[model samples]
Structure formats: structure tokens, C-alpha cells
Target: MKSLTLLITLLCFLTFSVFAHPPEGVWKKKLVWKEDWVQIWKTVKKEAWETKWKKVQVPVWKEIQIPVWKEEKVPDWKIVKKPLIEEREVPAWKEDKVQVWKKITKPVWKLIDVPVWKEIQVPVWKDIQVPVWKEIQVPIWKEIQVPYWKEIQVPYWKEIKVPVWKEIQVPIWKDIQVPVWKEVEVPDWKKIWVPEWVKMGIPGEKYLGKDHEGWEYTSHDLWRKKLIWKPVWKKIWRKEKKQEWKTEKKQEWVTKKVEEWKTEKKQEWRTEKKQEWRTEKKQEWITKKVQEWKTEKKQEWKTEKKQEWKQEKKLEWKDEWIQVWKPIKKQIWIKEKREKWVEEKQQIWRIEKKKVWATDKKLIWKDEWKSYQAPIWKEVKVPAWKKVWKPIWEKVWVPNSHGWD
Candidate 1:
């Protein structure tokens, strides 16, 4: 029991110690690449040649008779008509009466009215009311005051005291009762049986030789067993009490003294007087004169004369000439030609062969470099400490005229 208890206590202590603290920093993985030269198998093309059947054009020349054309001139005649113009005096116009314009002197008179304008100077006067303004000086009496700062004694916070609470750990000792098991011997009893013999007789028994006359009697010995209890002792485990002392931690409250700073406010005042000036205006009236104009017209009579022309028709006798055409026999000579064609044969083209440069594709092996990503281990930076602001009280000297009004 003691060994078991000690084993349990040791396991609990190991578990608590393992979970108390944790590991710091972080684990990181990165990818890295390395350059190296290696052999690689690749497909490449090369030029080669082999024998093959190819079609070609062959050129041949042969000569045969071909047709040739010849030209000759021949004379021919034709008949055509001729035109002539003759002038002979014949009566084509006759004398007739036609009206014509004649000029004569005549008198005409007309009465017309004409307008004439004349300008004259005339005086015009009008009565009108208009507004007029005049500037005058006005005295404006005003009392003005300006603000100024005034200093005085005022109450302000100087220092302060505050109570602070803090936590502390305390150790205490305690007594505990623990049960103990021990091996000991105890007394006990058990019962068992044994076999024993006893004498026995039968009543009214005759001679045993006669079997059938009287009652046959026989004597037999009987055996029996009895049970009894016996005391015995054995070794076993027993429980016992024991007292032990243990150490433990407890929380307690404590008080402390701390000093802090405070702020206060106050007001100030000032006054002043000044003077200013302004101006005013008024209205006035006046009279004006202007000039005017007028127009007049009159009528008069006059005489005019104009000349015109008229057309007339008359007939007179005149002479004219005419053109006439007549048919006559005349010979015209022209040149002509004759053509003939004949059958012939000629050669134009033939077949031939040529040689040229060409390329072909094939497979080969080559070596090159390739890139890939590989895993690697590297050292990286991690944050261990950080900056933080803590609250604390501090005292400083402040001036009275630091704020605005």
C-alpha cells in the first residue's frame, strides 16, 4: 500500500511539472533550390538523305515546215454621184405695205406737288422734380471697452494620497491523518468428523439352525462419525492510523501608500474705453431748360414732254440663188489583198531535271538543366519582447496662465 501510494504521488507530480511551462518561439518551413549539372535525354532532329523515285520534265526539240503569209496589191473601180450649185436670177420677193414709226413734235403739261423742309430754333421749357444728395458730417458718441487679463490668487490642487491593495503568498503547516496497512496473525476454528465402532443386540432370538420355525434373530455391530470444532490462526493485512504534516500556500491582502497629481481652474478679467466717428447725407432740387425743332412743306406745278417710236410693215421685190444635185457616172480606183493558210508543225517545250538543297528531321540525345522547388531548413527571426505602457502617478509644476479665455 505504501509503495502504491508513493507511485501515484510521483505520477501526479510529474504531470503537473510537465504542463507548467510551454515552449517559446515558432517553427517555420521554407523552400530552397540548388543548381547542379546532370545528364538528360532529349529528342533532337538532324538532316539525312535516301534514294527515292521523283517525277521530272524532259525538254526535246524537232523542226517541221510552218505556214508563211504573203501580201499583194490589186486595182478596182466604182461609180458615184456628184453635186453642183448654179446661180440664176429669179423673182423671190414682192413689194407690200408695212407700218413704220414716224417722229412728230407735241406739247404736254402736268401739275405735281413737291415738299420742302426748313429748320428753325425754338425755346422749350419743362418743369420736373429730381432728387439731389449732399454729404454732411455727423457726430456719433459711443462708449467702447477692450478686454484685458488680470491676475489674482486662486486655490489649486497640490498633492494627493491614495491607498493601494496588493496580493501576497503565505505558507501554512497542517496535520493530516493517514491510514496504514500491516500484516498480522489472527485465531480461528474449524470442524471435522472421525469414524468409531459400538456394540448392538437383537431381542427374542431362537436358535439360528432352525430357519423357518421361530423368528430369526441376528446381532450386528454399527459404526458412526461425529463433527467437532478446532481453533486456528492465519496472517492477514490490517488498517492503522497515522498523523502527517503538509505545507500549503494561501492568499492574503495587504495595503500600501501611493502619491498622485491633480489639476484646478480659475478665471481672469480686464476692461478699456474707445471713441469713433461717422458721416450722413441729404437731398436737394434744381431747374433745367432745353431746345426744340419743327418742319413745314409746300406744293408746286411743272410741265414735261417725251418722244416714242412705232413699227410699220411694207413689201418689196428681190432676187435669190438655189443649189441642185445631179447623178453622173465616174470611175474610182482602190487597192485590195488576198490571203491563204497552210498546215504546219512546231516544237515549243520539253522535260528536264534539277538538283537543290533540302532539310530533314531526326531524333538525338541532349543535356540541359531544369529548375525545381526543394524543402530546406533555415534560421528565422521571431519576436521575443514587446513594448507596453503602464499606468503611474507623477507630479509636475504647472503655470496659472496656460489656458485660453
Candidate 2:
């Protein structure tokens, strides 16, 4: 009954009004006996018998201890009573991982002073210099001052230099004829270019042919008048040297052809051979070749025999006048020796004569180029204006490939 009383009193105290503040001088405790059970019923405005009906419609949720009594049969009643003790337990200790105050981080910014250049767009009134060139034509002549002939042939890339003037032109884009830097151009006609004679390739000096005609062609030497010559007698005359006049006709055995070559036995040539053996080797060789040649005796003497070859031949002609000729060595490479008799001064020829350079070649620009004021450009208020500054540029033509005005 004592335990039952403690349980009911605790339940009655818990059921009391929680909104009431404890009065002064009154004990306030969480656990109380059934002494406050009347207060709980009064606050609800219901008698103890009606308490059940009062709370019937109101939802009440609380821990209530209803003592359930049951008698148990024991083998030995009250043999020994166990000591009354409160049970104690160890609780698990856990640390909370949730962050209380997290620090927020952001990128740091720095104020930087940057340099800027502003480009202003404006027309520049520069005295632009331009050159106006006139055409200069160079003649492609065979010789220095002569027109090319039918037989003369010129090759490519033959060049000649002629004096030309420098022209300075003013763009005249602006109203004023202010002169800029002098710019010149060498017009195609005005420029002296490859000449026909120059393209003739060393004027028979440098040639692929081994020799020119029967005469020798020598390499050009500035120091000496005469140079060495290799006879392309081998190259140009390779066919002539190795030529065989072969007539591919139907060949037949002919006793007549062989018998025709057989000459009558002449005692005049073979019988007196012992005396003719005294002939000089050079004369013998010349005589042998001359005898082999098939021609009229008179024609052979006049054609094969020249004044230079006279020394090697015998004076066999029965002529009316006895003509004598000069030495043969002096007559080489000469058309004739009669020119030697002419005045020595008259024989000398001047190649380049009466050639002069001309003036007024290129255009000339006016003199405002020295100190000309350029167009004014201004920019304000725009942040981008401070970023760009460009210079003014002008162009003009140059003379020829190598020279300029």
C-alpha cells in the first residue's frame, strides 16, 4: 500500500496544470504525493467522480503506473529479502562532427595602374612624294649603234646600262603641292635593258663551237690582245674528220673498175724516182697530195697554189709577168695584204662614238617634305581610346632595280 501510494501521488502531481506558476512561500517540486490531486481536478472544473467524463473528450498522453497485483506461491515464504539498490549503467560518449561556424574564402583583388596609348583616327596631310616616270626604250641593235642584220642573232639576258634621270612626284592628294621625300621610278621604256649585241654572247668570244671557221677562237683575256684557242676541229668537225662518203648502192663485182684505177706504166714518174728522191720531205708530202687531187693541171695550179703556198710549190707557170709575193706568215688571218698598204691611221676603227646620257629622267616632288604638319586626331571620354596609337605611313616607287631617287 505504501508503494501504491507513492505511485499514485506522483501521477497526480504530473497531471496538474503546467501553466500555473508556483506561488511564493509554497514548495514547488517535480514529484509530489496525491495531495495535489484535488488541485488538478479543480483546475479542470470537475468532481472526482466526473473526472473521467471531463478528460474523456480531452486527449491525455502520460506515463501511468497501474499496479497489477498477483499472488505467487513460494516454496519458502520470506526466507530472505534482497537488499534494495539502484542500478547504474555506462552511457556511450560520441563527439558531434557538424561544423559550428565555417570560414568563407574569396579571391583577393589588387588595384593595378596600367599604361595605355590611345590611337586617334584622322587623315594625315603628309606631303606624299611620288615619282612619275616616262618610258625610255632601248634599241636591240646587232652592233653598238647599227641595226641588226639578217645573219645576226642575239640571245636572252643581254644587258646594257644607260643614264636616266630621277623623278620625284607629289601625290597631289591634298590641295597643296607639298613635296614629300623624293621617290623615283624607272619606266620600262626609259630603262636601258638587255641589248641585242650583249646577248650575242661575247661577240664570237665565248662560244660552244671549238673554232670559228678554219681560224682559231681564243678565250678573252683583258691583259693580252691574243688569247688561246682550241679548235673545235674535234667537236664541229668530228663528222667531217670521221666522215665516210658511203654510197649504199647495189655493189657488183666489176673487173673494169679495178682495171680503170690501174694506170699505164709511166717511166717518167717511176724510172726517174732516184733523182726525185732528193726532194725535200715537206715538198714530197705536198707533191704527193697534189698528184692525188683530180683536176685540170692548169686549174689545180691556179686554185690550190696561193701566194702563201707559193714557197712550197715550184714556179711552173709560163707567165708573161714574173710576180713575187711577200712572206706567208704575215698574210695569215688577213683578207688581203693590200690593206697594209693603206694609211695606218685610217685603218684604225673606233667602236663606241658619239653616245651621251640624257637628262630629265624622273619626276621631282615639291619641297614641303622637310617639315610638314600632319592631320590632327583627338580622342576623349572613351576608355579604349587610351590603348592604341599608330603612325602614319606613305609609299612611293623606286628607280630601276638597283637605284632610287
lDDT of 1 by residue, 1-405 (tens): 423744775685567559965323233332112223444433334334433333344443423334444332222232322233434444333323344443322323223333322233444444444444444443432343223334543444322223244444433334444443333444444333344444322222223443342323332222244443332444444433243444433323344333322323322121223222322332222223322333333333322222333332222222223232322334443333333443333211222333322223334343322334444443333434333222223332222232341
lDDT of 2 at 83: 32
Per-residue accuracy of model 2 over 1-405 as CA lDDT, tens digit each: 435845775564555535455322333332211111111111122222211111123333433334444443222212222233434443433322332442323233334343333333443333433444434333332323332323322232322223334444322212323222333433232222232222211221332354322323343322323343322322121111122343322212322211112123321111111111222222221222111222222211111221221122223323334333322222123222221122111111123333332222333333222323444332222222122212222231211222231
The regions of model 2 sitting more than 4 angstroms off are: 1-295, 298-348, 353-355, 368-405
Instruction: Return the top candidate by lDDT.
Output: 1
Off by over 4 Å in 1: 1-155, 161-220, 225-230, 248-405
For each candidate, the alpha-carbon lDDT, in order, equals: 0.34, 0.28
TM-score of decoy 1: 0.14
